[model samples]
Target: MSAPIPVKVHYHKQARELELIYENGERHRLSVEYLRVFSPSAEVRGHGPDSATLQVGKKHVGLANITPAGRYALKLHFDDGHDSGLYSWDYLWWLIEHREANWADYLDRLEAAGASREPLGIEIKQL
Candidate 1:
């Protein structure tokens, strides 16, 4: 297979947006909400198959900062303080390329399961 043409990644913390500028000079904007819900952290992506941890309420989350990892990948620091997963060039590229389709599928999963992206982890208080 041919190698990727190499792309440039840019993060705007205030806007909670990430962009990938491809070799072809095309740029793609990736939203913070999308990155959070699809976080690659161990907290979200488990060690093994079927061990995936589904994230909720991340639709409004955004990037806190970005750390460079060598020259082929990035260490994404989410506003939620998650920085475990290292997003490789291929993975990030794939995400940027397929963001729309994947996000739609995620929403569909929630709807089909009668689930929501709202918080389910809030502590309840006794009346």
Candidate 2:
């Protein structure tokens, strides 16, 4: 009836990913860049529809920390200095379910906006 809470939450620093394991033996991993780009914070989500601030140059973003926000959500601290956003259990599950589609959508948005995921000051140019 309710969203399932992850039984285990692990951040793989080397892999730059967050791993979630549910009680039902389901597992999911979200990249740091993906999490950073899709943060629930108003800075990322904006105040309403069509108002979200496009996050660019976050491919190298790392998780500085992940703290619990009471018992219902998580407060993610990104190394890039973004500390807002409360990722609730329902949202996490939703992300797990929609990872692929969400990623595709994000990429499409980036393309439309002429944004690059590479961190600022670093560009890969092929001649």
Candidate 3:
């Protein structure tokens, strides 16, 4: 069997969801937070195996832009200044298929590390 190909892609800012329509007539919706935390960039996934960097404090991150990458993948630009991840079609499908398990793992890791999805507020002190 051949891999599934996307027929259309839509990003809803208010809902913070990415809707993907596949050629096989399957549709999938993925949240912005999930995509951001699981970005396929080296900055997040690292250069070698087992080097994924845990992305925290991105529960409200928004998609700034989505640019096509040579008809094989997409370059997602995030509102938090992240624009390196190239999400391929296969990767997107994998994310959709494993959304539940992946999210559970992320939550477990966050709890174990005492990390939070809420952004940290920085206070500036005036001298």
Candidate 4:
């Protein structure tokens, strides 16, 4: 099975959503926060096994830009200054297919680490 080509890619700033339409007739809508935390960059995925970094405080991260990387992938720039990951077509398809399970795993990890998705400075103290 060949990878599906993206027919349309639209970023909705206000909603912080990246909408993708594929030639195979599949449409995937992903949140900016999800994309940030799951970035395929070395900073997030790391250079080696057991070195992956957990991204936190990105619940409100927004899309700044999206640039095509040759004919295979896309470079996503985030409002929080992250612009390294190159999201490939295959990767994107995988993301869309496994979003729910992946998100659940992320939440579980965050809970295990006592991490909050809320940005640091704006966090409210719960006394």
Question: Each candidate's lDDT (Cα)?
Answer: 0.74, 0.89, 0.88, 0.89
Tell me the tens digit of each residue's lDDT in model 2 across 1-127: 6679988999998899999898999989999898988899999999997899989999878888899988889899988889999999989888888989999999999999899888778554322
Q: Quote each prediction's TM-score.
A: 0.78, 0.92, 0.90, 0.91
Model 3, runs deviating above 4 Å: 122-127
Q: What is the C-alpha RMSD of each candidate to the true structure, in Å?
A: 5.0, 4.5, 4.2, 4.5
Candidates 3 and 4 compared: the better one by lDDT is 4
Location of the lowest summed lDDT over 10 successive residues in candidate 4: 118-127
Off by over 4 Å in 2: 122-127
Tens digit of per-residue lDDT, candidate 3, span 38-91: 999999999886888989988888888899999889999888889997998889
Superposed Cα deviation of residue 82, candidate 1 (Å): 1.4
What TM-score, to 2 decimals, does candidate 3 have?
A: 0.90
Write candidate 4's Cα lDDT for 2-116 as tens digits: 5687999999888999999977787889999999999999999999868999888999888777999999999998888899989998998889889999999999989999998
